[model samples]
Target: MLRIFVIVIIANAAMAQVPFLGTCPNLEAMQNFELERYLGKWYEVERYFAWFEFGGKCVTANYSLNENASVKILNKQISSLTGVATSIEGIARLIGRSDDPKLTVTFPSLPLPFDAPYWVLDTDYISYAVVWSCTNLGVLNVRNVWILTREPKPSVAVVEKAYQIIDKNNISRAYFIRTDQKNCPVTN
Candidate 1:
């Protein structure tokens, strides 16, 4: 009896829908992404908040090629709630081929784990990048967007370029929260 009730609750949570600012079909992923050039550190300048990443500040992602031909993803953040640094490591594998920017990422240590899309929408490889991913729940959508930069803070021009791609997809900029990159503690 208790087991059945627990299953029902978990089912409802799995079917939860995230509120979005605009209506549109899934945006297309960028093509011909340079795998080597894209492998590096990227600072999260802004992002649309997700439940798993709420209250995270000074966020950054480091990507490196692994021996298995997959990419190792290290995501680091400063937790506002606990005032501590936190990080998670995951693996990203190319979906079908090396030329495409579409990939799937998974955290093996996470419970009830699943592979999630990690699509690159646009990138300059020098200054900024725009990434988008979404999961469908019936007619609703749960999506995430990230504006990443080569530096902790990006120039206005760099940010504007990313915004153009965001606007093209009809993703509301209002949902994006600017990540705090000021006066960060030095890491050894």
Candidate 2:
């Protein structure tokens, strides 16, 4: 009975919004990260499934500097079914050294007790970026990943480069799904 209970709990946690498994992976954030160069719009090329992003398409995130020097986050997404556009604003601040690409992001719209990790695993600032986050929860860990590009529809070479980084990091590609960027509503 105890074994059965443990199996059930693990199964339930695995079905949560974020993928949960063993301890968090040993991954390093980008070193010598330039905040100024990374501050711009990034379109979602691919990502792990997220409940809050269900039915969302043409997802994009815009970053800028806030008055307090914290990074401002503006995430936008359009509904594939309803064609409705929605967005959320958030704040991000470095969690480590100035050049470290590790940060914590908080959305005032969500009633969460703490900020979520937003770590840039790799990036070239101009073409592509691989972002990853993991939280160790004792018996299990929750993980998230996103492959972003400066353009909504990046070339094959650009995407392949992003995949190379993911492969090098040994991150599983099973959960990634391409984001639909076709017929997206234009913004000025």
Candidate 3:
């Protein structure tokens, strides 16, 4: 009886950290994403904080096409605690076909497979992009959502549209944490 009780407690704790269970049929990636237009710097306006990104502030991602036709992803951030610049580089392989926003990123530093889905859920190309990714962990799904913009802060209306896209994906808005890009001492 005591062993069963312990198992129940462990299960609940695991569930609490998991983002969601099962698939979201309504959550769809962009039909067509222009690679050229998306090739630039993007500031992280908001996101559902992943464990790896804890204590990171003024985060930004820069994308460029490599000679091998893969996308080079450079993620940079300032440590909120120590105020130092830190970065990680990853390469994203285009999954399935061209023009599709689905990708799988692999980081050399990480031993565990970094081959996670990189889906562009919604993007205007020029201004804002809503990206989503999910992977099954045991019986539950761990999800990551990011709201990125060409500028540090997009207009409220633009952000509202991004939120609508997230809502359509069935992600709870309560989980989002707004990134602090204001007064970031670091420059490009």
Error of 2 at 17 (Å): 4.1
User: In model 2, what is the error at residue 8, expressed in angstroms?
Assistant: 13
Q: Estimate each model's TM-score.
A: 0.86, 0.90, 0.86
- Could you tell me the C-alpha RMSD of candidate 1 in Å? 3.3
Per residue, candidate 3 scores C-alpha lDDT tens digits across 1-188 of: 99788667546434433356664334678887777788889999988867667778889999999999998999998888888889999998889778888888887787554476788888998889998877654445667789999888789988988998988877788888889897776566
Q: What is candidate 2's CA lDDT for residue 33?
A: 93
Backbone clash tally (model 2): 0
Worst 10-residue lDDT window, candidate 3: 9-18
Mind sharing the TM-score for model 3? Answer: 0.86
Measured with C-alpha atoms, the lDDT of residue 160 in candidate 3 is 88
Winner by TM-score? 2
What TM-score quantifies how close candidate 1 is to the native fold?
0.86
Give residue 69's lDDT in candidate 1 (0 to 100). 93
Clashing residue pairs in candidate 2 (N, C-alpha, C atoms within 3 angstroms): none
- Candidates in descending lDDT order: 2, 1, 3
Clashes of 1: 0
Model 3, 139: alpha-carbon shift in Å?
1.3
Q: Point out where model 2 deviates above 4 Å.
A: 1-17
